[model samples]
Target: MTTTTAIGYENNLPTNDPASLIERTIDVPALGAHDLLVEVRAVSVNPVDVKLRAGAHAGGFRVLGFDAAGIVREVGDAVTLFAPGDEVFYAGSIDRPGTNQRLHGVDERIVGRKPRSLSFADAAALPLTAITAWETLFDRFALTPDDTGTLLVIGATGGVGSVMLQLAEALLPGVTVIATASDPERAAWVRELGAEHTVDHHGDLAAQVLSLAPGGVDWLFTAHSEGQIGLYSQIVRPFGQITAIDDGPRDIAPLKAKSITWHWKLMFTRPLHQTPDLIEQHRLLDTVAGLVDDSRLRTTTTRTLTPINAATLREAHELVETGRTLGKIVLHDGN
Candidate 1:
């Protein structure tokens, strides 16, 4: 109905370019049926944000962000899950204008109550990565609370893996979590997040993994499938499973020998397709919030920038592009 300030890009450009992201005045998004109009308080930057910002949007401009924490301002006629004063968190669908704006309209089915124990900035860091890890475990891998096995997580210090390690420890106490961290600092970080063992992904993956588990792992979660698919096949046990979020052509021929099942995840699939079960995201986020409140899980936010402006978002994108951030980076609305 009105307008609000937002950070967005008109043309795809390098993160360092002055025009890559800019402040613009946009219409305060109108609510759709089943949508919650949220006054976004904090947002987090993700690798997907960087990737999408590097590509052109169909409309020649796009707001870019997914993970966010906010307070509900209004709700669509079809929305029954939330109210005007509720605090919420969610990872937005790729098909929509993102969370970078002050006011955002998101489907209530995909949003959840923010963790009451966390600051908005910290809560903002959980949504996107949390959903990716949650879907991979409960949906793709079919991991259960009673299952007992060794799980190998490559790139374990980033947002998704960091949260995954915690989830595994809490939800599948019988399943051991072995995480890959290239350096001792990262190793310590993973350990703090509940990783039972640490291996260097830069080293001999097979040797390290086999040393930890003689028969190799029962499940593998990787962020660089294209680079390590063959190695994964070697270190995962017969009939083991793998779920990857990497982007590239993966030669799965190596997996057939051991019958290792390789599954890919995007986290956006449910929301993009408007799948009937997409509300599972809401349930997952609520579960994560409960864990956070219970101290069984922790926010992966490692950095918090202020003001939620174009300059800060640019810096956040640059940090993500480095591919070395330990956890998530969040931006506050500076309220």
Candidate 2:
């Protein structure tokens, strides 16, 4: 019998207490035709991990992790993009067991060749955030590097914001980025990531953005949009676009009058719905890896823990729950 070590929760827990996550030895399931058995080396926690824990399945343990970087130990007969011994990075599907275990099985259509220059932990931090940022800017907003415009990024120090700011700077040639970070430390971090100017998200958002671009920004990307849809509508130019990844019901009526375009980017949509374009995730991550290897973009890993385990996962979850983390936190467990 083949078994692997994994950390999981038996039921939903309100808090990220150490007891909420537990270690277990579980059987490695048989792979599907398109599955790639990944020897998980490093993993990163995201907001969705926390949100999913709130409603975790009750019948059995639920493993929660999305971003992973590792080597492919085995590949299904139908797989073509990757094979055994290939280094890879991916954000696994929401419908399948995640990459929190020592071994995980994911579809080849959604995985990418890992950047040659990055360590497993650094590569682990890129997938989920990179996919979200890439999809939001290119797919949702129809933006191209040649497009000349101004972009306003709110909550610019979080995982998605950190990557979005960099991607915008690298991909959009003639655009200006006005990012919002609450404190000096976060402000400096975003600036380092290529934000042209920084404003305080805790202060007057619209006023600050207006001060920078009095005519209004051509595009707006909000990492945290709980009560700021109205403000986004105010600061974005008429017929301009707005994109967001925050979960929750938001009243988007404010932008209607101005005929402003708004889009919600859920990185899991392709996997969740089993869309025919699911392979696009593979293509996107591959492109991102090339950019990273070319020194056009860098990993956003702000912290890393040696060896993956339940206790460390609990600590990582606690930090993610604080809603104050900069960039990404990764846990590395080498093979």
Query: lDDT: which candidate is best?
Result: 1
- lDDT per model vs. reference: 0.91, 0.88
Off by over 4 Å in 2: 14-16
Model 2: lDDT equals 0.88
Instruction: List model 1 lDDT by residue over 1-335, tens digit each.
Output: 59987788988888889899998898988788999999999999999899888875637668989989999999999998999999999999999999999999899999999999998999999999999999999999999999999999988999999999999988998899999999989999999999999999788889989999999899999887776767877899999999889884546788898998888899999999999998999998999999999999999989999989999999999999999999999999663
Error of 1 at 229 (Å): 1.9
TM-scores, all models, native as reference? 0.98, 0.96
Q: Can you write out model 2's per-residue Cα lDDT over 34-141, one digit (the tens) per residue?
A: 999999999999989987876656468888899999999988989999989999999999888888998899999999999999999999999999999999888998
Q: Tell me the spans in candidate 1 whose CA falls farther than 4 Å from its real position.
A: none
Tell me the lDDT of model 2 at 10.
84
TM-score for candidate 1: 0.98
Q: List the residue pairs that clash in candidate 2.
A: none
